[model samples]
Target: MAFFNREDIDNFDKIHRINLMNSLSGYKSANLLGSISPEGQENVAVFSSVVHLGSTPPVLGFILRPTTVPRNTYENLKETGFYTINHITQTIAEDAHHTSAKYDKGISEFEMTSLTPEYKNGFLAPFVQESPVQIGMKYLEEYYIKANDTIMVVGEIQFFYVKDEMLQEDGFLNLSKGRVATINGLDGYAIPNLFTRYEYQRPKKIENSI
Candidate 1:
């Protein structure tokens, strides 16, 4: 087995260290965050950090790299207070990954890739037409992580659109049925299969030894 301590990881090559650190958390949710500038310029970028922050408020959060460089998605969402989170699917994995490429301001990733921008009910931000699960979000708050200089952006789910068949009766989203993609590392995309899902657990009485 391979072992890496703090010092060893710190001394690794830049690319190697980044890859190891990013993938160490295992498979992450692959999502495309869609936003529109006040001037109506649309931007979409692939992200693997989207996470459910709370159920009561239907809040979700995602991590963003430092703002030292230009981040169109972040800028747009901050200014407009709206964005879309779309689940990446197996069919659009390549195009979804391509959105990660840095582009100049005002350039729409939807135009550069095969993906299509979808607008519904006059929502300012667009959603990926090919995604099986699409969520409209309203910017809520953000926290700065001093340790890594990253930012955690939080939002409240305003609208949710999922394929009917993918939603189970108990309100569980069976992502495997929709063929949603997950990120392994920086560039690896995979479609996970469904393993058995256990029911909610409860503490059981211990059996005394005979």
Candidate 2:
């Protein structure tokens, strides 16, 4: 058996861990980048770390640093309870990376990324029109971690839009042709391959079919 100690793991430091995490995109799930804008003008950061927490009641979440660095996203979500999850596809990867340029307030990153902001259902948070899939979220809870200042944000999914072709008859993601995007780090994005797919019910009867 192989074992590893949490502290003994050499890549445990923040910078090292973050860099190590960058390598996980190739193996783990890829997610959309999310951002929040106060009054629709704050050019905040773009995060590739967004994740879907659930579909029942539709939960979504992301992690953010807890520093007092004046994060516009935290403020916007706090004030408006609204944000946009923009899928980062292969084509828009460069622009998505550009969104992290640390722009000042009132500067629209959209102006430079060529991604038009979109609004739906009278909600003002604008998602990227180019995304094959986009979702609107409302903040629900914020939980803190003791070891670090990072916080986990939970939000409710209010609206979702996806390309018609991306859903199969079974209503699951047709990843084989979703034309979606995934990230590897601060600057890597790609559509991964389709490997084997199978039902995951375990504790099975033995068979020699193979």
Backbone clash pairs for candidate 1 read none
Evaluate all candidate structures by whole-model CA lDDT and list the values in order.
0.95, 0.71
Best candidate (score: lDDT): 1
Clashing pairs in 2: none
Best by TM-score, which number?
A: 1
TM-score (C-alpha, index-matched) for candidate 2: 0.81
lDDT of 2 by residue, 91-118 (tens): 7767767877776766767776777776
- After the best TM-score superposition of candidate 1, give how far the Cα of residue 191 lies from its true spot, in angstroms: 0.5
Which tens-of-lDDT digit does each residue in 80-106 have in candidate 1?
999999999999999999999988986
Pick out the ten consecutive residues of candidate 2 with the lowest summed lDDT.
27-36
In candidate 2 the C-alpha lDDT for residue 159 amounts to 80
Which sections of candidate 1 miss by over 4 Å? 208-210
User: How many pairs of residues collide in model 2?
Assistant: 0
